[model samples]
Target: MEQAEIQAHQSTYEKEIKDQLDIPLETLWQDAPIEPNWGIKKNSDGKNTFWFWFGFKGHLAVTTKSQYITSRLMTSANLSDSKVATPLLKKVEDQFPEHFTTAILDAGHDYEPIYRQLQGDQMGAVIPYNVRNEPLMP
Candidate 1:
């Protein structure tokens, strides 16, 4: 692609993200609506990997040493896991301030805002990269 084309694409993408972020976070999960969760079928090649189920997804923040849930949130399966991290962490922080020092999470929680929140809370975030959403090198 030409330089102009790349710049235009980036500009459009940034605008779309800003528009999405403008929506109130609370409204994002005000209702428990059935949504699709995409899953890959086992023993299938990349071409036929897609499958889904309509349901809700449960997210939990647990105490590492005690194995007890400190916070939880449920949302439509379609919701991105990254979207719930900050809220869930906030809840944990409110209830158990200074109780934990690190958050271990999967690649789905690999988002800039989530990391920023963790940093602001004086906590460490151990999350892998979501290749589809981020550049390989950071």
Candidate 2:
């Protein structure tokens, strides 16, 4: 087979894998719920030092170089950041499909499924989870 043919085969395989794992955006939105009455308080030295008195916590998607927030998702504080990644990403894709070239995420957003989905779209994912105890480059 020619090099172009091999590349096409590889691309087709990746698309199939992505399709199998993709979750509909509507489903994702329905699954994520907001708690209006939720609150948190942390006490230190006999005084309240930190408080989330009401409302859900927010997950923000910002441009790495610009530091501008592009999108936001509200979720219960109890939810992990990783869980919100997909839906938030879908929203971003819908709004600016051609603008995003890379996704720079923290350790909290490190997950295999997320990485796979991002890469499948030709988006660079910079998540350092250290699953194999290997040192990450600086």
Candidate 3:
């Protein structure tokens, strides 16, 4: 929500919060309109390519039985895990509502727009939220 919407930029990341603004934004994600960001970072076992680095975010959903990937999405190297996830879930819901009515997402999935859409659509979604931002608890 930095208001960088119009610009054709994507895959924004930094080593430190202090270093956030200085970087030149070299890459663009495969998907446009990426909102929230999520991914784990490790320097390839600390090998330090230094040349290569971006968040690796992917979507893998399974049935309650842990049998198979009900639906999955492998995002471009640099994009928010949450951004890719919501759309995938929405698509699944749209195409096969009978197969998927309720969805459970990790705390990373807690975003205002996604949450609102799920609620508005009357879809069951279990989303874990960050404790500090817990509006429902108090």
Candidate 4:
């Protein structure tokens, strides 16, 4: 009920939380043996409000090179995960444009508008298409 008590409690809480995160913190930055994928976490506290029942979506940018999350964004408590990746990608790109030269993703990131945008840049993406009809390397 007093400022001193609150301050002491806050400091203890902070230290406790930091102490709890040691393993995951180190693991998050470890070098990876394989590429990673972007994710959308479905927050389960929602949909229930509307009688449907779904949670939240957490959009994250993971480093395929390091298997680490470079960045993330928690969408409005009601938005879809798919709806967040694009904006989140833009945010990540704006913050670290140098990190992406050739961005490769699954069919999802191959949106026509996005493809056109990436095409204009030096981004070499392996999007889905009629590769069968395309010329092979000589």
Candidate 5:
């Protein structure tokens, strides 16, 4: 192809990618509804613990056994971990559909909707949240 044609093709490809990856302006600037788990607090032992103030929170998906980080998502700190779990999992699923079969998350990701969605997708979930006083079986 001619140099001009090649340049035109490259420009078109770049535009297409930019369009696909674009986020809405409102969503980009939206703040979390509440303050994050930051600031200093005194523990029961009278020791002060200081948590750094970060505007955003990072969620990471790692291999269970290997501990290799596979995917990550960043959101405003005010957003709960449960709120972003599905979106982060969906991104990972899109990237590696055939690799992951189960997801193990903490209590913060113990939302029923997330569990149901994972179940619908034939994915196993291991979330330990104490809705009742019963112990969760492994």
Candidate 6:
């Protein structure tokens, strides 16, 4: 493709990534309770990025050994992933008491409260550092 064509394609790709859907609301039909929400994406360097979309997010608790999903929660895309972690874990814990000993999550769930909740339940947390969440020096 020509340079202009490449640039145009890149622009279109970026636009699509930013706004996943552009359908007319009047023409759209939905049976489930869906909502528009923004989500974060970590780059290769672990830097925080963002995107907007209209849909639901599926939070699940899976077993490492059996690779089976024990608990699941579906929420609007606007819901923070961190917010769902504890509840999902609680569901699993309540459903299958003492079945899991650890919770492995990504940097998106690097919140301190999540850590405390897991610790309170005697569960280990393995979440990486999310620098974006760190407090800046004065």
lDDT scores of the candidates, listed in order: 0.65, 0.68, 0.52, 0.46, 0.59, 0.63
Error of 3 at 110 (Å): 1.1
Ranking by TM-score: 6, 1, 2, 5, 3, 4
Worst 10 residues of 6 by lDDT: 23-32
Q: What is the C-alpha lDDT profile of model 1 across 1-138, one tens digit per residue? A: 996676566521122232223334354335323455543333334365565756677889998899998988876666656667766776677677887899999876777777777876689989987676765786
TM-score of each: 0.65, 0.63, 0.53, 0.44, 0.56, 0.65
Model 6 residue runs over 4 Å out of place are 1-50
| Tens-digit lDDT string for candidate 5 (11-130) | 211222222123332332242233354423234244576445656677788998899888776655645566556555666766778578899997656666677757755689998874
- lDDT, candidate 1, equals 0.65
Clashing pairs in 6: none
Top lDDT prediction, candidate number: 2
Residue 122 displacement (Å), model 3: 2.5
Pairs of residues clashing in candidate 1: none
lDDT of 3 by residue, 29-86 (tens): 2333334344344443457445444544456767776657766666555555555554
Which sections of candidate 5 miss by over 4 Å? Answer: 1-52, 132-138
Q: Which ten-residue region of model 2 has the weakest summed lDDT?
A: 11-20
Residue-level lDDT for 128 in candidate 1: 85
Comparing 1 and 3 on TM-score, the stronger one: 1
Candidate 2 lDDT, 1-138, residue by residue in tens: 996676566521123223324667766666566756555655534575876655677899898788988989887665556677777788788778868989988765666777876775668988877453356779
Error of 1 at 82 (Å): 0.7
Poorly placed runs, candidate 2 (over 4 Å): 1-21, 36-55, 131-138
Backbone clash count for every predicted candidate, in the order shown: 0, 0, 3, 6, 0, 0
Q: Model 5 TM-score?
A: 0.56
